[model samples]
Target chain A: MDFAAIIGNLDLYLQGLWVTVQLVALALVIGLALAVPLALAASARRVWVNFLPHAFIYCFRGTPLLVQIYLIYYGLGQFAAVRESFLWPVLSEAYWCALISFALNTAAYTGEIIRGAMAQTPAGEIEAARACGMSPAMTYRRVILPSAFRRALPAYGNEVIFMLHGSALAGIITIVDLFGAARIVNSRHFVPFESYITAGFFYLCMTFLIVWAFKFIERHWHAHLKPLRG
Target chain B: MHKLIITAFTAVLLAGGAAQAKEWTKIRIGVEGAYPPFSSMTEDGELQGFDIDIAHALCAQINAECTLVPQDWDGIIPALLARKYDAIIASMSITEERKKKVNFTNKYYQTPARFARRKGSGIEVSAADLKGRKVGVQRATIHDGFLTEVFGDEVEVVRYGSQDEAYLDAVSGRLDLLMADSVALMDGFLNTEQGGDWEFVGPPYTDVKYFGEGAGIAVRKRDNDLREQLNAAIDAIRANGVYRQINEKYFDFDIYGN
Candidate 1:
């Protein structure tokens, strides 16, 4: 009923928007870095090479993201050893704890996505690279990884959005992300509908931006597969 | 087949239970079992504390059989409004905002707000000392409202969804300070084993504008007769020395602030 409350408190939402963007961006970048190695091991032929990544992926992806966040944020803090550790400074802060959870969670999901894409890479293409005297690692580096990445992009986009949505949970541990801003607004103003609808609108806007960016990248990468114009 | 039949039988029982009885012989009082000294559940699953004892004493005075329904702090008010219980014996502060939805009996008990921190933390209560310090408070509480209205962005105020969560963070050294009802701080945290290192600091915040007229029993606005009965019972207990017995069981000083 009161759209004015949202407009008046736009600064709070915008500040929270910046916090959300920073969290998601950092998590996605770090997650991708971790995911590459994880996917490589997961796609490996040796049982030992794949075992850890398999377990990590299952452990993260099988459980709820909220529980994972709590385990790191509150559960780890429960131990006196963790509290006294050098990492306590960073671990004690909600921002870093949330960052670590989001990154690891996204890495597990993204690792699986890339592993699936790597498996779907054409055997003929890998065979051609090997026949050209490329080493196994070079074949993977040159042909498999590049094609698999292109294949993984769309699914990776979904992971990015999922990570963004997961950032909402950061507020529980006291990081005021976008949804946290809505909660603060609601608590202060007692206007749930107006507060949440504004937050929803902001999320919708960001979702559109992510979709557009991914679409542009997809078109650019898939250009070679397009039929010749002239 | 047995499971389906049992489910139908339970549904019929629940439907029958939903209809309110005209007689006030049996009453349900909602309470938050998490708050210690006021109302907390023992390991044996029995509710005990000042609030529970007072509820029992009041029920005796009115000749009604009362049941204490354990509810979470956040849902306590909404559940009272939903007719899930006849009254909330929870330590609910009577504020103008809540007065719209539910009628509150005369104050059963009142306590001032206080700041608590780790012993020898050496922080004073002034805004200058607390600048950039992380102060933990329960979300949507009078203390939280006070912090926001007074401190605003001057200090880093961390609001949690529960007092237990805030206490956890406090024990972990994540919070520089905590604010809550003085009695809550004493029994819920300070007197507990986990809070051995914590101590109350600064003067008590007894601002009525924010803290309101203290904790009172909350009933539905339509329950005027119930509300009046509760008011009379509160007075009767205070008059007949029953209130003192309950107070002495938990607190040393008078919680019924002048």
Candidate 2:
């Protein structure tokens, strides 16, 4: 019942929360940007166009994100060439290494989610776009992408929460995210329950907010499917 | 500080060992099979190393049939308190902070902390020189606290889950410098081919406030009888040359800090 640990280490937790927010927010945004093109290529008819994206998704989704983070953070620096390369500056920092791995890992998962949504795009809707003189690029940009994004929204929300949880791994690489803060507290005070319970509570609060926000977005997006009000 | 008091009281409940004097036999020892040259798992799950040999020797000296229980480093203490094992021989330090929760036998071995870096890196241990440098240390260890207390934010502290992970970062150039037990660094990294270009930097840090009195066998706080038996066995072995035999099996030098 020594919940006072949370109050005493409040500043440390806040600093950790700030880092977690930055890492997850930046990773999700970058992942969303990469996923769009990845899904498009993955869904293409030509094997050459789809091959690279398919492989990228499989490699990432197939392996654990923790291993991917380890490889990027600790693996990349082992190479003499990597150290000599211009990218060394970014690769040398744990923050950047964590960010890069998280971005890439999320992109693979998000790409598959969007690709599944796109595959279900009605043939009639696509035909209507084509009949209206919409070019293929224009059709994807204006209709296909928009429709797929709305359909993928719920799944993407889940991915966002998963990313939030996954960012805890940043602590292993030395980035003091929320989990890291709790770990520090636990190690220092030897109060594993109090420290971790505080962290779990924070995460629970965040997950709830994300769910509520997503529910609002779904309501607005599914307005057309709702019963008409007199 | 308040949490420290709370931890002190709760430690009583966690390690609630029966205060009765019991005959010592068939004891289970907690060992972390992850630290190399001390205790590590072979490809086939057989455990071997200095700590393993020492544990065996101690058991023989005390005439106790012992079983080695493999445990992760992070949870070793909690596991000990939970009565999962009667004692820990995992190269755990005898420190004031740890004294709050567990009792320790006399130190079986001692080593000082040292920093290592690129051969020509020219990194000094001073706060001014270490400013902005990334120093890697195993998280939740004595070295981590020492580094933070010494330099505060002057150095960018990178704490890894294990000492091995820190060495990997040291090899990858992600860390400008590294810190750990001198013996551990020699065994875990300096002896490896990847460590060819790395050299020990800075003087050995032996502040009792941080490094403590060195590695000791830990038992539940109320297990006074077992602690006495372990201490006598340690003394007996050290006098009978059994300690040296085990020490030389792994190290060419005195590992007991004699």
Candidate 3:
């Protein structure tokens, strides 16, 4: 393997890394924003309230991300109604289609993660909040959400990494993320090992950064829960 | 019991008949149904194109029944290697790199690579002229290789999974230019309404170092006999004017380059 081939195209690799970061960051923010409401609705007491969110979760989570992206990017474009619609401007672009698919896909998984953590909220904490005469909204805001998020952090961090990896599929729709960059280099240079090994290293570094960041956040938020250390 | 015994005897006779001899009576040929002029799907879900016609002609000459298998371009070769199909009639150029993995027959047709841009774009198709411009091409193709090799440092080469996607980007003005097989560009894009505003720019590039020998049917390396049969069939079709009939159905000029 010629390591110099990889080193020579460092700029292209970095550009790919940047695209991957942008895609993951934007998709994660959108997904998390959607997941909070989705998880809350999915956990609602009323069957009617939970039905749609449950269906949404099942539909998005059950399907492959590649299919979802293709549906958004290609299938939608096939219809005249979609082309003539007001949202055609946003729906037509590959970047937005990829972003929308990634966001919806991660939302289903993240919603489940948050819902699981919320289910584990201690009974004593809820009783204490009720005893203080806190409103249902205030009780959830001050006590439940904070605690649930802290507990959900570790699982959510894994979702973040998965989303980052899944962002590689954006290349299929013509977005030049890290994987796309590696493909371009590989096709051009005809050196699969050098090109992909470089991309793998970049992905590894990103994964480590995500893990480290999550560890720091866990330390800060779960400080009281930590056992005393020497 | 008498009926069961009769059924068993008949089944044994049928099995013996089926085991008598095995010959190349049927062949499955892979094609990328997305590449237009060469191969594409009609609105009625039928595969129709020059490549499909050529496959039919070749199969007829070889006296074998042909089954066209629709495959994505990226996985077409690997699928052939895995025996998903007996041969690939896809417009895959014969290259040394690909030859290392799969064997190819003699050229069925050859075409040069060219760049297309929106009509009246006033952009020159030179390395210095395209510096920092975004050019779209299908990923993992000879055109992609040529662009990257020639202008990797000078231009931004955006890769797509399919030529159709690159054409879409070019139509939407996301790409300043698109590079692909000249005949494919003509039949798949430039001649269509979506590409009405686009025109071919720059000279046709046929550097053997990159574009390879020509488009050929690919088979597994072990299937040399099949490869030879395909080459003979290709020659038979060309000599008998069947190749010209299919060629005229798609292009005005001969795509079988010198």
Candidate 4:
């Protein structure tokens, strides 16, 4: 194996790294926005209120993200009416198609995390808020959401890492994310194992950063829960 | 228990007979939908161009109903091997390295590989000029392998998943030059408004090392019969002028095996 060939295109590799960061950052923001409402509705006790998002979360989670990207980019593109529709402008670009798929996928997984955290929010705390004459909306806002968010942070961090890796699929759809850049290098060089390994190392670095961030958050959250003896 | 065992044996035998008698009424032919003028989808979502037309002619010749399966180029070879499709009619070049894993028919269409660069880009127009400059080609292609082997590590190589993507990037000033077949580069960048933006810069290059003689129908190596059938059909099409008619529809000149 020629080490120089692997190390030669550092600029291209860095550009790919930058694109990957952009994709993950954009998708994560949109994913969190969608996840919040879906998770709240899913945690609702009313059957009709919770059913739709539950089904959505299940379907998105069940299918592979690769298939989801294809269905969104190529499968939906097969329809002439869809091509002619007003939404065609957004759908025409491969970047948006990948973003939509990653956003929806992350939202499904994150929604479940948030919903489980909400369910674990103490009932006594909610009852105490109600006893204090707080309105239902106020009680949930002040008591439920904050607690659920704190509880959900660790799991949400893992989802963030997964989303970063998943955005690599954007490479296949012609998006020049970090992985896409690496693919370009590999294609040009015919050195798949090397290019992909370098790309994987970038992902591993990002994964470590994510873990560190979550660890810091966990420590900050538990500061008030320390034992009196300690 | 004896009666049940006899009934099970009879059922297994009947199922095996049904499996053996199943005829291939419908066949799937994988095409790279991104290679325009060869096998590309239109803005209106229809699969059009040369490969689509040629596949129809071949299917009629073989007396088999065929469906054009749109597969990504990188995955096309593996997908064919995995039996995701019965054959590949994509603009797949028949190379010796590829021949070890997959079989190919006689050359259906041959377009010499050319270097494409922006109108005034100082990037080299020749293989010797390519030293130290960045060039892009589609991955897993004979062109990519050719450049790597011939140019060595001196030239920077960029890979694109599809030809269109590479062209867009090259036009956007991301790549110094992009290389692909003359027929595709003609229909892709040269035939459009961007035709002025990019032009073929180098002499057409062809050899076993670079272009692999020409493009052909690709099937699994074990499927030698399918390879023979496709080669025969291609020969028939060429003899009757059907191949030239289809070639001239997309290209200004004939691209059928020079």
Candidate 5:
């Protein structure tokens, strides 16, 4: 580890850190928005409706994100029609392509977590809502969702961290994220181990912060379960 | 309804499987996509520039089915040895370090190495000037080996994964000087801001002692017949002006220095 090289390239490294944070933040927000409805649809009684989201979740989760990124970015570009389409503008940049892939991947995992939590929602509480003449939509919105969010917090936290780490793949496609900057530095400096290690240290710090935040959220959600001393 | 849907889905799956098995028969040609003007993917998702066109032409000339497999530059040789591809057409320089591991066809394209510093930075280095400066060169390359031999330990050599990144950092002011093939450096300078700011310093240095004998298509060591076939095709192309046509299209002039 050349401490001097790390110190010398500190500004570039910091810029890379900010890009990574942006990638994760944007991906998580979009992923969560897509996941909740998919989770609800997957648990639906209709076979056709549930099958659509189930297959979506399975396909995204099964393949490596690297392959997905390439397919979306390079493979899609091969079609001239795609280049002429409305999506061409949005898909033209590496950042948006990576963002779309990461968001879709996180949605799949987060959906599964949410589905599992929904399945565990106490049937008796739903039954009580029905007796009170509450509409199905009201019952889910006022009761079921809050409980499922609490139940899904820990697993969802893991998904958040995975999405954050997976954002590193953006570097391969030329997005100037932390790993991308490290790769550039390593190429210039010829110290792969040192450059990558510095990037990893920053990622570790970010991961630790994420973990700390999620733990606090978990504690807050579980506070109701704590027994009061008589 | 469910039964019909299941039956239709099954038929579609079978048809898709059969189609994939028959379409675009596999012929793997390895490439280092990190090298632009060769096979790098642009930010907008195009696997284009030069080597791609050349590979397509070669496949058509040989009447062989093919696919271009993108591999990292460092592992390209090892991957070929492991039977990962039928041939390597990356902008790989034919060097002694690589020749020990793989055989080369006759030179496909050749460009000499040149030095660059930020334009007007007044940082000029003659062959004698690199005695004790930190120099950046792409790793596992003839250029890096040449610098090591010429400057000895007086030069601090840094190896990069690709020429593009090396030039990028040099442009960003991370390195004092960068060394790469004239063609690659030219591509960088023409396509990038860093290239605009960095001027090529000194005359290009060539020959095996410097830039090696030029770039060639790398085949397995044991594939003597394939090598002969490739060499013959390259010779035919050169004689018929096909090589010149392709070369002229992408480069400003013929880079296969005499």
Candidate 6:
């Protein structure tokens, strides 16, 4: 079973796991932050306000993340202006390129999820908030956003896991995330099963933890919506 | 029910056709169309490279209709084993580790590995000198193995999916140095516009322990007859000056190593 190889490369696996976590966590936070505004703009009454955001959502969601990453990492580098620009320092690093691609890609999907949840918000609750003398901003902030977030939690959880898997593509761009480490081991030792199986185990562990955490959050956040027992 | 019976009969006939005995009449050859000077795609999607020419020459010698299948380098071996292609004519080095999984023809060519750094970087290519420096290499290559084995503790090895990626990183200054086949570096990168600022920094390394014998066409283990045929073709091309003709087209020096 080549237990020795797994044990020997444990540090590399952990380092890769650390990179994967950093990529997913940072991207998720940035994506959600960007998504909130995008969702609001997408749901606005003014056609002009929603147009660009809708286009952005469609472009990002429609294209493959791998192409987006390659464009940012290699495509941008092709331009003399990009190379000479102040942004070159960040753009030159594969780590930053991967993070930016992940953030942009996830923002589109999360924006749609939040927009859908906002659309599904009951008209009665919004009316009740307005009836209680709440301002438009207060009604959206206190009632609509909270309700939408709770509803979006389950779907958002899936996006989180999807992003975790998507982060594997970071390896292609030269960032040694979990999949990269496995690839290194596989190439070096020629033990594909042992090398990849160990990485898979780590991914499975991460997935389980994510699922458990989301379940815990869902239980508390959606307590009011839970069915009653006799 | 009548239509289902007809469909079943057609399926059986197709299966019977596929199970027929192998004639070396038609052979599918896999090539990584990304590696330039050896194998690369033109702007109009034509595969043009020294390796492609060599594959054609070999196919002609054996009187077979050859088909070139472009595949990503990482999955090239597995694709061969799965019968996605009958053989790999990519610039795949003949190594002991690879020999365990697939059989390789006699080497078509060999070249030493070399390291390159920016013209004014002043970074010496050595294990001690490269401490903590980021060195770029194409993943799943002999150079990657050599770098990791020798300088792994002293330097950070950044593995890219393709040689071009490593070249890009090196030119962008993200990588302190890049290691790859000497001829490939010269033809594909160092002689190009973006790579104009880079130059080889160390003596060419050709230790057989890591670099292996040379680049060879790889076929599945069960394809011994095909392997023998390819080896004979390689010898025929080399003897008849055809190998030198292709070599002169791509490289000035003899790429066939001692």
Instruction: Point out the worst 10-residue segment of candidate 4 chain A by lDDT.
Output: A184-193
Say which prediction, candidate 1 or candidate 4, comes out ahead on TM-score: 1
In the range A1-230, model 1's lDDT, one tens digit per residue, is: 77876888899999999999999999999999999999999988999999999999999999999999999999999999999999999999999999999999999999999999999998999889988999998998989999999999999999999898888999888888898888877665556677888999999999999999999999999998789999
The numbered model that scores best in lDDT is 6
Candidates in order, TM-scores: namely 0.87, 0.91, 0.76, 0.62, 0.56, 0.88
CAPRI quality band, candidate 1: acceptable
**Candidate 2 chain B superposition, TM-score:** 0.89
Best by DockQ: 2
Which digits, one per residue and each the tens of the lDDT, describe model 5 over residues A133-181? 9999999898888999999998998998888889999987657689888
lDDT of 3 by residue, B1-258 (tens): 999999999999988756633445689999989889888999999999988999999999999999999987766765776788999988889887788778899999999999988889888987678998888888778887788889889888787877887887676556788889998998899999999999999899998999999999888886677788888889998999999998888788888988
In candidate 4, stretches whose alpha carbon ends up further than 4 angstroms from where it belongs are: A1-152, A166-223, A226-230, B1-25, B126-132
> What is the iRMS for every candidate structure?
2.5, 1.5, 4.1, 7.5, 10.1, 2.1
DockQ ranking from best to worst?
A: 2, 6, 1, 3, 4, 5
lDDT of 6 by residue, A57-99 (tens): 9999999999999999989987889989999989988999999
Over the stretch A13-60, how does candidate 4's per-residue lDDT look in tens digits? Answer: 898888888778888999899999999899888999999999999999
Cα lDDT, model 6, residue B93: 95
* Backbone clash count, each prediction separately: 0, 1, 0, 2, 2, 0
Q: Which window of ten consecutive residues has the lowest lDDT sum in model 6 chain A?
A: A184-193
- Per-model C-alpha lDDT, please? 0.89, 0.89, 0.86, 0.82, 0.79, 0.90
Kindly report which residue pairs in candidate 4 clash with one another. A16-A178, A184-B159
Point out the higher-scoring one by lDDT: 2 or 6: 6
TM-score, ranked from best to worst = 2, 6, 1, 3, 4, 5
After the best TM-score superposition of candidate 3, give how far the Cα of residue A175 lies from its true spot, in angstroms: 2.7
| Better candidate number, 1 or 3, judged by lDDT | 1
Worst 10 residues of 4 chain B by lDDT: B17-26
Candidate 5 lDDT tens digits, B48-95? 757777777777666668888888876677678788996899877777
lDDT of 4 by residue, B129-232 (tens): 77777677887788878777877576876666788777755654446777788778888778787566888787888886667868888887766667777888
